[model samples]
Target: AENARLRAREAGSLAELEAMVAAFDGCALKRTAKQLAFADGNPEADIMLVGEAPGAEEDRAGRPFVGRAGQLLDRMLASIGLDRSRVYIANVVPWRPPGNRTPTPQEVAICLPFTLRQIELCAPRFLVTLGAPATQTLLGLKEGIKRTRGRWVEYPGLVRPARALPMLHPAYLLRQPIDKRLAWRDLRLLRRALDEEPPR
Candidate 1:
């Protein structure tokens, strides 16, 4: 909903961007969504994390990863000495897709510009994409989440040494508990990548 494009053009600081995002109402997602669910955690965190979109609870609560999936995410991040307050968290689409369904390409396109502006404003050192939708869209990869998760790929268009590590979505892990182990492995790999280099 934020004027992401204008923010990109004129943003000089994080405070300014947050103020702009708090007032934006461009995307259609804002029409049905209870809240914008703009972002969570430290605005200046070194690590920036992205997820697919808001789910049922997220839609109601107006925050990213704040449901059961979010609880699991917190535990996973704690395993590697990270948490929301220490790392910035957001979503590819700012609003919840209807009925919590996956966002269509048209929806993604509408929101992409704003998200790009957010990244440009935040400028995190490491990038992590949660779940297939986010990884596929962010990396523009045709590969499936199974094939893409845990594989290292460089995120495009950034001023930092950004590495995008795709991991299983917590919602998926809730349904497929067996895959939680796989997600753990992916998290470890993320830890390693984060350790590879400091912010540039």
Candidate 2:
């Protein structure tokens, strides 16, 4: 795994990192997954969204955020006057897990480097981790999404530092429509962040 991480660190761009991930065979989840759902949206966007893993639709389409959750995500972005074209989107685990179950810690560890490399390459000004897994994985927080969502946390160890925000996954909102209001609040926070000038 360290070898993979080193290769990932050496990747010159998101495209190269993605190619590495696609060719990676360390994680068992990749074997069960239909395809690699690397990412979607503009790679140069200032805001990057990261989710846990792909669902059935995403696995089939080979693109992140393309299911019902994706439709809701589109609306969520629209609410903040943003869209896929304006923000880059990827997942902590590029490959889908069996039965859409959460990726185990071991699986996550194996795949973390690739995602980290992707983040380093994109160098987005702000990052939004959708759901507790992504939030914990990227932000290094043990707290649940409900506790961390809407709050700002700085993520270092990348090409550039970025302020990250945790938000409820669109899939969660789909299951709990009542929580869309809370998600809306987080979206507003993201909008404000986007409006602010980047630090010197």
Find the candidate with the highest TM-score and give its number: 2
Those runs of model 2 whose alpha carbons end farther than 4 Å from true positions after fitting are 198-200
Candidate 1 residue runs with Cα over 4 Å from true position: 1-7, 18-25
- In the range 1-200, model 1's lDDT, one tens digit per residue, is 23466555676776666566556666677788887787888878877888999888888887888999899999999999898878988898878888998888777766776677677777777778888778877888768888888887888768654777788888889999999889989888878867886655
Best by lDDT: 2
Which consecutive 10 residues in model 1 have the weakest lDDT in total?
1-10
Give candidates' CA RMSD values in order. Answer: 2.3, 1.3
Residue 187, model 2, lDDT:
96
Clashes of each: 3, 0
Question: Model 2: how far is 134 from its true place, Å?
Answer: 0.8
- At residue 106, give the lDDT of candidate 2: 82
Candidate 2, which ten residues in sequence have the lowest lDDT sum?
A: 191-200
Residue-pair clashes, model 2: 0
